[model samples]
Target chain A: MKLSHKELEIQSGQFGEVRKLALEHQMQVGKFFDAQSFVEISQVHIMADTEALGLAGIEYLENLAQYPDPQKQVWVPTITDPRGSDFKSFKKIKQNKRFVDLEKRAIDAFKQLNVMMTDTCINYQVFMPPVKGEHLAFGDTGSSIYANSVLGARTNFEGGPSALAASLTGRTPMYGLHIEQNRIPNKFFNFNVRPTNFSDWGALGGIIGKQMNSYWDIPIIYGIDYKPTSDELKHFGAAMASFGSTPMFHIAGVTPEDHLAQNKNPKMNNISLSDLNNFYKSYLPKDDNLDVVVFAAPQLSLNEMRILSELLDGKKIHPKVSLLVCTPSAVKVLCDKNGISKKIENSGGIILEGVCFYNMHAREIGEANGWKRLMSNSAKIINILGGYGYETILNSMEKCVISACQGKIVK
Target chain B: MKENVYFGHIGIGEPVKGEALVADDNFSARYDLDRINGNFSRKSHKLFNQSYVNKILVLNVAKGGVATAWMFRSMKISKICPKALLLNFANPIIAQGAAHANLPLIDRFESDITKIIKSGDIIKLFPKEGKVEILNEKSTN
Candidate 1:
């Protein structure tokens, strides 16, 4: 890969150890992917949850924090994805002290490097949505997909280290999603049913995700009757990315990229309603009892918060079941102001900010709380929690709330 | 010494030799692994309950989660990780993670790596050279 004089200086340690490390990290990733040069990225969203980072990752950050040069601060406007533990609710959620301490240390290290603790996967919805054709260094799969497909921004799956490196260097290796040639759709799907709700959208996405199965697959979907809401697309894109590791998808006449996609109909596979039903049915629990009900993964948007509050209002969650509501801190403030958080909390649901359930030492929390059976509206989270020893039942948001009230899934 | 050589794309990290733990299933450190135990813990995974420590994991592809990129580094620090990863198809996350962890990972082989490699076979990786040698194979007879 070719380097600029400024990049050479950073590599030569003229800018200090932090920039040097960042450059080396980018160069390593660059050479691996055959990136010819670096592309300047406008912003970066880093997924540095403490669980993923662990003590070793945190210690690595602390080592970086030891550098005193302010010149080593992030060159771009960098924010964070959801943290592993929400400090305000970690103890209540049964997260251990070690988890909390690691979260703090990681945050401190990031702050030292001038990274904002936005702590959200839904940064596109709450904070700032990247514009069409804008290049970014985004970490979360959901964020990358949404930004790429929906908003028409460009980003590959920039992980914690890569995103942070892009932050410090203000540039990322020009490969993968950064190049325009790779954005073309290879797989086409024609759906039989029009998805009306968030769950339907998610269910459809899961089927497509399973079918696509590879990161290189860009599925251009057709036959949707109407445009989905941001929240609906959130669930859809998040589930697709989670289930398939797919980065970008195009929805006919809806997403921005669809217009740029070739007009010639790529050979399309017919996706029937039964496929969606079967996908949902596959995750259904055998037993009726519910240990927990969660409303997160991509974290809740404001509209989702409003709807959840409306459902929980004037009702009580079953004593035997625990309901968790995960949202971004910024959105939580609005939910609080709108009394959405209060309503859910008053009905026995815990509204946690900045941390999704699966990333918060899920296995340990489940063991500590004795929670083995779980239900959630997020197809992404339910798919993930299964691996963490939870028996998950994937259902619609409405069905999930009803399950919370009755203390078991309503079959 | 019987050896069958296979060529792959230039991978990350130094060359190393270890027994193969081949599976047709896709991988994600966040979705399919118990990092602390160095084992495949996802019940539905093809390699479920199998220990991956010190082995050359030959798999179909990488699936889901950007967390795997950092996870390789975290797993490496604790010494609870596969010695190398050889997948038929590689994603950006897998490549980035391999770079971060300095874990030898080669992908984009001429054929399905999982079909070529079998469990318990001795395998050696030459990352810079993009070459893999199946060092020892038991005869079918």
Candidate 2:
């Protein structure tokens, strides 16, 4: 890859050993992708929860953190994704102290490196929304897809190590979605039906994702009668990225880059209502007894929190069932200030801040609490928990709320 | 004893030899694995419940979340990782993860790797050379 003078300096350790190591890692990835050069990135989001980091990863960070040189700090604004455990409510979910201790160590290491602990996969929604055509290195697949498709910002799915590397160097390999020609749609989909709720939108994304199950295949969707809200697209993109490693998508009239698909004739597929139903049918409840009803994965937006809060009002949760709601710390602050958190808590639900469920040592916690059957309105979460030894049920938020109250799957 | 060789794009980590565990399915460290038990745990996956430890995993492509980028290193630290990854195609997450973990990974083969390679085939991978060689042919049973 062609390196600028500053990049060459960083590579030569003129900055610091930490920055030089970061550049070397980026160069290795860039060479694998055959990236021609480095693109300066405006911001970066790192997704290194303690569960994923393990002891070695934390040690790696601590070694980098020990470098006290100002040049070792991140060159661009850097933030974080959801942590492994929510300190205040981890015990409520049966996550033990060891996990929290690891989390604290990871946080301390990040702080020493001058990284911000935004702890959100929904950073595009809650924190800073990237402008159109901006270059960024975003860690979470959901956030990367949303920024690329909905916001028209350019990014590939920057993982934890790569994102941290980019944070230190303030640039990433100029490959994948960073280039304009690659952004054009290669596959087309026509929607026969519009999504009614967030879950339906997620199902739509799943159908399309399963069809175009590749990082290289970009799908251009058509026939949406109305503009979908940001929260709706959040579930849609999150599920798509989960089911398929889809980096970016285009909605013919809805998304900003739909015009890029105008002159190309890509293979077309139609997504029908039956397709959505079949996607949901694959996750049908086995016996209806539910242990947990979670509303997370991409974490909740303020609007989703308000809707969930109202859903729980005047209702009591079943003593056997646990309803866990996860949101970013920023959104949780707003929820607390606006009584959304209190309303949900009063109805026997637990609100976890700065933590998403799947990454929070999910398998261990499930075993601890004997949580066998899990239900969630978020299609992304349901898709993920299967490997963690839970029989996941997918449904709408209202139905999920009803199931939580009754401690069973609602028909 | 005839050996068949195939070439791919030069990849990450050191060259190594291991028994191949081939599948036409895609992979994700977070979505398709029980990392604690070192097996393919997702029931829908073709290699469901199969142990992947110390084997060369030959798959179609990489899929799902960015957690794989970190999970690979974590799995390596715990001594519960595949010997190497041989995919027909790799997403950035897999490539980045293999780099982070210093695990051998080679992808973008001239042919479908999963079809050409079978489970239990003794294979040698030369990542820097972008080459994979099978030492034994399938026996007629």
Candidate 3:
């Protein structure tokens, strides 16, 4: 699984330990496959959550600290916090000293890695989209699949291997996503109506996920004319994958390769459409009513922040309900830099750092706050909330803003 | 009373002393064992917070051994530490009659059927469980 001499020494000056970790982690992964492991990986896309890993999170930076081997891996550090997570919550982690010392050890490590640190995974708009026949190694599960299906990039939910391979030996299992001939469409979708609202996207996504379970298919979704926001897309992507284990999808006009581009429109094997009655029967749980509205799972994008700020300008949050927003520190810092944070803060929404409603285990945060009827401007938050309570509802950022201002669902 | 079967390595045999349990593969044991419905990690899970118990746990398949074996050993060490004899997630099940395999505190490891099948049909060619069990292999593969 070793590369040519030139590739082996490609990351020499970057950060030695960072280099070692990358080689170790990725090569170890390479050993799993019988053949073509090192040749499989091409490009790297990072979807980071440093706060979650605490000290160990630095291990990621350590790996990133190196330049990638050519003739092998090209890495993209997708989104990261502007600076990095504050060392406060991370100080509590007991298992990692290497990571705790990251500030001193790895600031140089990040300098070596060539990937961009865009702080937002909710939107995959910043970088070059993976081409029709390319195979990529991406970490964000939703994005990985989205890139694979919509953008026509090839990748598995193969994060650890992809990340490691890019860092160390710079390779992957070529058997899965690397092959060009294997990149054809799988599932065919016939939409009943164009999804015009954020919830509409989620509604359609929910149906698609259920339709394609544990399989990869090309779903050509028709009729999605309204402008789709990042949060809406993230929600739809997560829900479709969570329930159905579906890895990829295609929205006729939105994705890189249209379903029509692939060898003629195959039969609509998987149907993803929404109308008033069926959307309710399929998406809205009988028990869902809406208690509180939560924003930020991957955290809200900058545009979302501005929209929310203007919406909540003069109104008070529902006296009985609560509105909470969690943004990665990087975005918060940017907002702080631009004064967007203060706008959101004055508008009555708290833009906290580190912890999010999804990964956090304490339901008390959701329950103790007395947000029995949960509403979300975010689809990611809505998906996680769906795990614990049945009353959660998914809505667009605009609808949520109005609800927050009016203190009710329809205000 | 419907005796709920927890097919995980969390609490395998010690429960056998007086507790009830069953041995199954890891993937199904984890995924098929729904949390919201309280299948494996039901109300009794209240005794602990995590979904699965500890000690003798099942592997993803007695083979295709990746995160299953070591993770269960980890679970047994702390996360899902159970009260009884440890059960292993093995194929041609780890002869339940074996004694040391049921040691109250020792974590028994087993692999899933899929792995064994995928790795090879010639069973005799496989590596020893203890040897494969020690690997902290990276995920790049």
Best by lDDT: 2
Off by over 4 Å in 1: A263-265, B1-3, B139-141
lDDT of 3 by residue, A192-214 (tens): 56666556666667667655523
Alpha-carbon lDDT, every model: 0.88, 0.91, 0.45
Candidate rank order under lDDT? 2, 1, 3
iRMS, all models: 1.1, 1.0, 11.2
lDDT of 2 by residue, A1-411 (tens): 889999999999998888898899999999998999999999999999988888888888888888885866888999999999899998899898999999999999999888999999999998889999999999999999999999999999999999999999999999999999989898889899879999999888887777765799898898999999999999999999888899999997899999998556666788888888988899996578899999999899999999999999989999999999999999999999999999999999999999999999899999999998998988898888898889999999999999999989995
For candidate 1, write residues B17-107 as lDDT tens digits. Answer: 9999988998899999998888998999999999998888999988889888889999998999999999987788888888889999898
Over A262-295, each residue of candidate 1 has an lDDT whose tens digit, in order, gives 7494688999988878888898766687899988
Give Cα distance to truth, residue B85, candidate 2, Å.
0.2
The DockQ of each candidate is 0.76, 0.81, 0.06
Candidate 2 residues lying further than 4 Å off, grouped into runs, are: A262-265, B1-3, B138-140
Cα displacement (angstroms), candidate 2, residue B127, comes to 1.0
Please give the ranking of all candidate structures by TM-score, highest first, separated by commas: 2, 1, 3
Which is better, 1 or 3, measured by lDDT? 1
